[model samples]
Target chain A: MNNELLAVRSVSKAFGGVQANQEISLTIPSGKIIGLIGPNGSGKTTLFNSIVGYHPVDQGSVRFQGKEITKMLVPQIARLGLLRTFQQTRIFSGLSCIGNMQISAPVVRSGLKSLFTKFPIDDMEDIEDILAFVGLHSKRHLLAGQLSFGQQKLLEFAMALIAEPKLLLLDEPTAGINPTLINGLIDRLRVANQELGITLFIIEHNMRVIMNIADHIYCLAHGQLLAEGPPDKIQNNQTVIDAYLGAN
Target chain B: MRAWHYLIILLLAVSAPFILPDYRTQLAFLWLMVILALSWDIMGGQMGYNSFGNIIFFGIGMYVCAVFQRDSGLEYFQGLLLGMGLGGLAAVIIALIIGNALLGMRGHYFAIGTLGLSVVAGELAGGWDYIGAGSGLTPPLYPGEISERNVFFYFLFFVWAGITFVSLWWVYRGRFGLAINAIRDNEDKAEAMGIYTTRYKVSAWTLSALFLGVIGGGVGNLIGFIDPKDVAFSGATFGVWMILMAILGGKGSLWGPVIGAIIFHVTQELFWTLFLGWQRVALGLLIVLIVVFFPEGILGWLRQRYPHRMRDANNSTEKNKLNK
Candidate 1:
């Protein structure tokens, strides 16, 4: 708890008659990989959304860097160095990769005066460097929509990282990525965590991928935390196995 | 290269008064339409909000200036300046209040909400006797000859159009433009990236309102008359025209709406002059044809065909530089 960069406590959220998340609690220690795995409707995405302030939680609170952010909106939460990506890969498809990167830094909140200001050249070059890091350097001017789905995911990752987020929440980053590119995405994620020192809290369904990367794993079942432990322990845990196989 | 292009347009705009003196008044109206279309594009084109309520600011500008000038005991130009100032302020204040509630609605909901606001404004203006109700108030009578009045208003509208164009051009080249395009492409992502979407949306609308309000005041002085529906709150005409012109020009690109406004105004003018009684019908058919065939707009079509150099080709030049 003391080393935690993000703390989610007793957070419960329900949509209409269904309870998507029922009093879920988790902590992501700074600069470590934390995995959230659940069945399709087990509320992995919901938890990510709630934590990022995409939606307000019905109960409980969220703390980032020891400050309460439960009532903050996505932009406010994101400004405090907490960021998240979507399951559907929400890059601005129409903008060039650099444009996407440039806009992702949240420089428009200063009111009307911002309209008159040009982006700093340093930010532009920094975006280029990040694009290169993500292996989209050659496609810097390419529209995100024109890139392959896997490439779009990479661009989305770069967009998220462009802000130098202290912590990143990723929802199904490898969902539609091809097997060949999965290794590449995983490597990028690890590098983003270890080299960049960004705390990663990810929701994934691919067991092999999660097991290979996440230091700690969480398994949610029926809107509750079924099990959480080190990847190897969680992999062999009987309750975790049951939660995955029986959730259908 | 871009400077030369702008230079040619600048020369043409500056010389139009002398070169086509007979058409100065009409040219002024054309510039006014350019301001309307280009400003509308800031929201409807770049941001994809498709607001139909933009005319609300225009009507307010018209009435506020008209009322101030009519009621003010000040000198002619003084009253005019004072009215324009107050009218623009009123528009900014109104936009600030309404932008939050209305801009929250996405896509068609935003469209309908703005449309409702425009119509409600028209209805409210009609009911409010202070601003002349259904009859519409008039600006202070022009002290100069009709031609002199037209020239003065022409310069005013022309200068306003120039300011709107240059400012929007600068805006489109910067981070604000990218943020706007991001909102158009995916607003949720824009927000999640830390760009406060509401602030951007409201600011864009406020900028649009500021121009519309000022130009509305100019329009009141240009015509020297205002009727609630026909002149001031003519949503069925001016309101729809702004959206159609932007769409016809291609919504997202900066020059699309500008080019769209020029061509649309010319066509509409020709119809009014040549076809007379059949103008609206002809305009309707033309719009249908544009919507059906070139929905991406004239600029969009050109961009597709050329794929090379277009000033407003989004990132064509930037893409080229990156490739190099």
Candidate 2:
């Protein structure tokens, strides 16, 4: 219990008759990579959505950095240094990739002065370095819509990095990317955790990626927590394997 | 694209009344259209709110200014300034109140809610007797019928149009512009990235109200008389025209609405003069055509044809040239 960065205590959510998540509890320690995996309808996405305040939970609490955040909106959570990315990659299609990078930085103070001034030079430099790190420096000038789907995911990831979230909740970062790019992306995620010190709570579908990357893994099934342990233990856990087998 | 290109346009705009004195009134109206379209774009185009009720601000501005002039025993110019100032202030206050309520409704709900606001406002203004009811009220009569009044109003409108364009242009290049564009693209994502969207939307609408209210006061005095349905709350005319001009010019670009206003005004004038009674039909047809055929507008087409124009200059020019 080395100072949990995020604490989800007995959280539950329901959509009419559908119980999307029930009595789900988890803790993510600071400076660690955590994985959440479940079959398509097992409430994995719902859990991620709840933590980021895309919507309210029917019951329970979410505390980030020991501060209560259950009542917060998405932007408020982001301002508090918690951020999440969409599975579909919600980059602004009409803006150039650099524009995407530029807009992603949290505004310190948006005032009448914001109307008259250019974005700070420091932000520009930061965006360039982030873009380069994400392997998008050459394509930064291209409109985000023009980028390939894989590249757009990278762009979205880079944007989240620029926001400088203390804890990041990524929804399926390798959903549709080619296998060849998977290793590179996983390498980048580690670098983000190790170098940037971002606590990553990733919802991953790819077995190889999650098993190799996550320090601790949580298995969700039928809207409840099935198992939680080290990645190797989760990988070897008979119950976790049987749940995936039954779902398949 | 270049400073000189804009400078030349500015010079031409300033000299338009002198160059064509006969069309001074029409030019003044055109400048007003530029203001309306550009200000409307602050919400409709930039933030993707598509506020059909924006004309309410214009109408409020007109009534407030006219009421001030009629009731207050101040000098003409002094009264005009005070009336306009108060009018803008009133519009901003109303916007803040209604904006918080109205902004919660997304997409078509927001659009329809705003549309109802303008309609209800017109009806309310029509029934109220203190503001002269349906028959309308005239501005304080000018002494001795000043000869250069058209030129005076023309230059005034030009100056206002210049202010609207320059002010918005500054915003469109900065952080606020990016915030609105992000809202337009995907509001949820913008908020998730840490932009407080409701505050931004309300603020943008308030800014639009301030400008519209001032323009309303100016236009009210320029016209000298106002009818609740026909002039002040002419939602069908002014409201529709604001959205149409922004769309025709290219919705999200800085210079798009201005160019659209010029083209739309010139063509609309020609249609009004040529077709007379059939101008409304022509307007309907032109809107249909623009919506169907040129939905992207001239700027969008230009952006597509010349991609380099839309990219930030931070990208090396050498790379740009190579891509070209």
lDDT of 2 by residue, B1-324 (tens): 567987998899888888998898889999999999999999988888899999999999999999999899899888887998888999999999999999988888999889888889899999999999989989886554444777888888888889888888777777777788788888888888988888888989999999999888878988989899889989889988999999998987777888799999999999999999999899889999998988888777676777776644222322343343
Candidate 1 CAPRI-style tier:
medium
Off by over 4 Å in 2: A108-117, B144-146, B305-324
Best by TM-score: 1
i-RMS, each model, one decimal: 1.4, 1.8
Tell me how far candidate 1 lies from the true structure as C-alpha RMSD in angstroms.
2.0
List candidate 1 segments past 4 Å from native.
A106-115, B316-324
Interface RMSD of 2: 1.8
The true-versus-predicted C-alpha distance at residue A154 of model 2, in Å, is 0.5
- The residue-by-residue lDDT of candidate 1 on A115-228, one tens digit each, is 668776667777888899889999987788999988998899999888889999999899899998899889999999999999999898888899999999888988999898
Residue-wise lDDT of candidate 1 within B66-181, one digit each (tens)? 88988888898998888987899999999999998888889998887877777788888889999888877878888988878878888888899998988887777787788888
Clashing pairs in 1: none
Could you give me the TM-score of model 2 versus the true structure? 0.95
Chain A TM per prediction: 0.95, 0.96
